[model samples]
Target: MAWLDKLKALFNFELNAPLINITKNSGNSNLGKEYVNSGEKIDILFDNLSKEKQEKLKLILKEKVEEGSKLLEEKSFGLLRELINFQRTKGEDKKVLDFFQNLIPKEDFEALESSLYLRRRFQEKRDVSKLKEDIRTRFGDRGKNISNLCTAGYFENFLMPLFNSSKEGFDNIYNVVVSRSPMAIFVHSAMGEDQITRDIKTGLEVSKKYGIKFLHIHGIGDQNIRTIKRCIYENKELFNYYDKEIFENNGIIIVELIL
Candidate 1:
């Protein structure tokens, strides 16, 4: 208890913090195994530090926070690329292309327009009509199938609102908050695997222990949306993250998208 109290002080955590339980029940147990520790290791490490070391660590953390703020300001064009590519494969209607163009940086939007002109010029020499149609068919079928399951809508309705809203709005929105949705797209080398796993596990455990549900979405594979929907509708409890009441009563679903 004293160690935990020291932990609360060291990490600036509130007293009586809820414990989160993360169980690996998906084919992606590797994803689930990532979330077993809840920063107890950090607490232990901090506990072993001398008073001088603790103060030094605090200064380091403060510095990192300032650095992270700067990094967040760097303009991210990844989403723009994804949207534009999706539109291209799906056969862009002029209205949709215009909408997406409006969302990108002016330079990027211009580049896309130039690329389209080049594509049209090359179209005369190559018989890519079939190839283009194939791409549209494959992606369109996949998109429509996933959309039917309403997993995107589920996240948008239940999970996204939490992130999109202020802290106070999140707290006030639900009487019994069920789960959290974490997209593990950071499996890339940019961030450490261990760190991402630990963060996910800790977040899920804490949320669940406090009666908030945590749902993890693996952002790597072809999302089997229909299967996930069946599992939810049938009350199958296929994964370790399952909360029966939440799935049964509210038609709550979880699906991962490439984007």
Candidate 2:
């Protein structure tokens, strides 16, 4: 009750509110978790609202849901989940999804986990050439929800900061990720781990060869660059951030080019 009370009073619409008290436990360590006081207050709030106000609020929220539906097509949701996981892995935006964990249905949670499990099993045994060929033959870039996932972390992190700190990096990211068939980047560090061993010269050469568009580097190992070479790599969960990989001596590694 106290937590929700405090949260309700925080005045979330304001942009410059001091968030210093966000971490505090509402002056009670002994109280049990208050993930929510209950939906009763929410019902009460709705009940107290004037009919006109309620209608306006419903319209506002309905519009948002409609907008979200347009954005979250099946394929986009999958890729979006991956990017969000990657961003969190880099510690970029935290606490963004904490509020929604409980809101999601239990069946949805199970289905998502099950789907990931199945995909991982398939990815582990994937043959990039054959798989790409099959994708070409079967999908041919014309499937309703198929997508291309890429990310050049070396260019984004090392080259961008050193060479064009102002806007090139941001623009490139936006074009490749936000635009270009609506693909996005920012993959697991394991995919881009070679940024350590690679020099700028090599990076430029590879970037130029690969059209400067980074494919989601599944992972790197022994001498394999997964995406450009093969394509079985690693991944984390949608929200849990679990490290799932199949990095054998001959596994995914497009992030690192062997010179």
Candidate 3:
């Protein structure tokens, strides 16, 4: 019983996982920190459960959390839609839209706007056929993916960092992939599930072996832009195109802690 109690402490059942750290510069960092934290808390809860309850809890926890996450995603998407609509209605000064659009290329901006508007109309009018036709006309085969992006909370926390990063003059990022899902390694490690943790550990190793910076925005939190700024400050080499190099070289020089 003493050994078992000690083992339970390892699970950190009392701990609450960290939330997405939004700041003045980096807005949301949509890293799905909530989702990751939910998983971690469940892991801790699982440790305290009776074996019989643990099995049922797994299914129940996953289901309830997923349902809640779906609703949150919907709400976030609705907020995003409203913001976009407001931007569109504003006459000449599209400063809000311009601020967001500056983070990505013009083509992506156009595609994103078209996709959001089409999906909104479909949701409001409940016309699947019209949506499909618009999809085919505008997006062709990529329509489904586009629709998915529109519905999902893609912009909520993910795109916020770009504003600060761009302002810092580190704007030449070749490609940016914002994962709304947290790394499994982080979840498993938090849960104290050592057996399966090795699998994710290997995956993390693989990413690192390839020198993949794999920017972990959740873990980095509000420090992300500042971290880059510091990297540029400390090393003159990264000053030219730090953002692009950060992505290109897996951020070996700039973001060791985040990776």
Cα-based TM-score, every candidate? 0.22, 0.21, 0.28
How do the residues 102-148 of candidate 2 rate in per-residue lDDT, one tens digit apiece?
43344433322333332333455643333333443544432111222
Clashes of each: 9, 9, 5
Candidates' C-alpha lDDT: 0.38, 0.34, 0.40
lDDT of 2: 0.34
TM-score of 1: 0.22
TM-score of 3: 0.28
Best by TM-score: 3
lDDT, candidate 3, equals: 0.40
Better of 1 and 3 by lDDT: 3
Weakest 10 consecutive residues of candidate 1 by summed lDDT: 142-151
> Where is the poorest 10-residue window by lDDT in model 2?
143-152
Model 2 residue pairs with clashes: 150-215, 150-216, 151-214, 219-253, 225-253, 225-254, 226-230, 226-253, 226-254
For lDDT, the strongest prediction is 3
